[model samples]
Target: MEPKTISTARTARYISLGEPGADIQHVFFCLHGESQALADFAAQLVNFDTPERLLVLPEALSRYTMPAGPAGAPLTVASWFAADSLLPDLADLTAYLDELAAEVLAHCPAGVPVTVLGYGSGAAAACRWLAGGRTHYDRLLLYAPVFPPSIDRRATLVGLPDRPITLISTTTEAFTTEAVGAGLLQDLQDVGLSAQHRYVSEGPLTLAALGTVGK
Candidate 1:
C-alpha cells in the first residue's frame, strides 16, 4: 500500500524533578538516547539534581518496542524523530519543545539559566531543536553528539557567540575519538561560537565527571 500521513493531537509525557517555588536556580531540558525511557534516563542524572535545580526530561515523540529473543521480555523505548518524515518531524519537534519550554519557564523565577542537554541520538534532536531558535537557553551540552548537515548552516544562529556549547563523551565510547569530538568543537569555533569537547570516565555521566560544565 502507498504511504499516507495525518496529524493528530496526543499527549507527550515528561518528568520534572525538584520542587518548583522560590529559590530555583537552574532549569535543565534533557533529551534521552534512542530506545531510552524518560524516567530511566533521569535516574542516571540524579547526581546532577539539587534543591535549587529543576530537571525536565522530555521523551521523544516516537515510541517503539525493541525486538527481543524468545525468552527476553519486550522492551519499549522512544526516539526523538524518524528519518522517514524528517522535515515535518523536525518542525513538529520544535513546536512541541517550544511549548514545553514556555510552560516550564512560566513557573520558573526570572533570570534562571536554562541548560539543554542531549545524549547520543538525542544530541542531534537537541541541536536541531535549538537551531530553530524558538527557545532560549543559557548553555548547550551534547553527550555523544552526532550532528546533521543542517546544523552547519544554523550553528551561528543558536547564540553561539554568547552561549557556551560543550561536546561531552566518555573515554570508552568508540565514537568519542579525538577526531570526531574535536572536529565538531573546531567546526563550531570556526564560526565564532564558544565550544569545547570534554571527556569523562568510561561510564554513565555523573556530577563529578561533569564538574564545572555550565558553570
Candidate 2:
C-alpha cells in the first residue's frame, strides 16, 4: 500500500498518581515500552503515590496486538510510534508531545521539577522529542533504551542547556546494556551534553526495578 498522511483524533489517556490538590513537589512523565500499556506500567509505580510526588502515564497512540503461540491468549498493548512511519509520523509526534508536555505543566504548580522517563521503545521516542527541541524537563531518563543508531546527538540536544541526560539500563536487556548504554551516554557527552548511564540491577529491566524516582 502507498503511504499518505492524515490527521485523526483519539482519546489521549493519561493515568495519574497522587492527588491533584495535594502539595505535589515533583511530577514525572513516564512512557512505557513496546507492547506495554500505560495502565500496566503505571500500576508498578505505586511508590510514587504520595503528596510529594505525582506520576503521569501517557498512553501510546498506536496499539499492537501480540501474537499468541504456546501462550493461551493474545496480548494487546501500545507503542509510541511505528518504525515504518518515521518521517511524517515523527514530525506529528514532535508536535503532539510538545503540546502534551505544555498541557501537563500548565496544570502543575509552577517551578515543579519535571522528569520524563521512557522505557525501551518509549525511550526512543523520548530521545526523539528531546532531539527535536520540542520541550524542556529537569531530567530525561531512558531505561533499556532502543533507539536508531544513526541519531545525531548534537541535533538531539539542540538548544538545551547542559544537564544530566540519564540512560538507565540493565545487564540482560536486549538492546541497551551496562556497557552499550554507556556508549550512548558517551556519545551524548561527546556532543557537548551532560549524560550519565546508570543501572538499576544486573537483570532484566522492569517497572518494579525502578522505585520511587528522585534527583
Candidate 3:
C-alpha cells in the first residue's frame, strides 16, 4: 500500500474590523500566536479599531490540546503547524492566506497602504509565506519572530530586502532574549535586509500598544 495526498478546500477562520465604507486609510493583516484563540486575540486588538484603519485576524487552521497544562483537564487551542508535518501543511496554508489577503484587498480602494503583523509562532508562518517573494504588502511587522532552525536563510531572504520590517522585542521574554534577538537582526543584515529593532518597556506579547506600524 502507498500513502496518499489530497487537495481540498478548508475553512479559513478570520475576523475583521473597520469595514469598507469607513475612512479606511490602512489595511492590516495580523496572525495570532500559538495556542491563542482567534476571537480572544482579535478582541485585544480592538483599540486599533478606527475610522482610518482596517484590521484582519486570520485564525490558525490546526487545533490541538495544549501541552504543559496545570495537570488537570487539557485546554484546546490552535497552532499554525505541527513539527511532524510542516512544509506540506504550510503549502496549503500559504495558498489560502494569499487568496484571503487578495480578497481583503479587493474591497479596498487603490494605493492604500498594507501592513502584515504576526506575533511569536504566527510571525514564523507569515515570514515563511513571504519568503517566496510574493510581495503582498508594503511592510511586515514581526513581534519576536521565531524562524525554524531548518530554514535556509538563502531562500527565505530572497527578494525581501526591499520590504520594511520592524522587529519588536520586549525588555524581558526568553524567546526574545538578547542573544536570540541580536542574532535574528544580524541574520537579516547578512541577507541585505536591515530591520529596525524596538524594545518595549516590559510585558507579554501584544500588538495593540505598538501603534500603526509602517505609517
How many collisions per candidate? 0, 1, 0
Return the top candidate by TM-score. 1
Can you write out model 1's per-residue Cα lDDT over 1-215, one digit (the tens) per residue? 97787888768878889856668888889998878867668877887788888989887888888887599776778977676677777877888889999988888898788889988777878877887747889888878776554444345234343677777876675653532576667667666777767777645577655556535
All candidates' lDDT scores?
0.75, 0.68, 0.73
Clashing pairs in 2: 131-156
Model 1, CA-based lDDT: 0.75
- Name the top lDDT candidate: 1
Model 2 stretches with alpha carbons more than 4 Å out? 67-74, 149-154, 157-161, 173-180, 202-215
TM-score of each: 0.84, 0.80, 0.83
Q: After superposition, how far is residue 31 of candidate 3 from its true place, in Å?
A: 1.0
lDDT score, candidate 3: 0.73
- Where model 3 places Cα greater than 4 Å from the true spot, the runs are 1-3, 65-76, 133-135, 159-161, 174-180, 202-215
lDDT of 3 by residue, 18-87 (tens): 7863367889888887788776676657667767889888888887776655775565568888775777
* Cα error, candidate 3, residue 76 (Å): 4.7
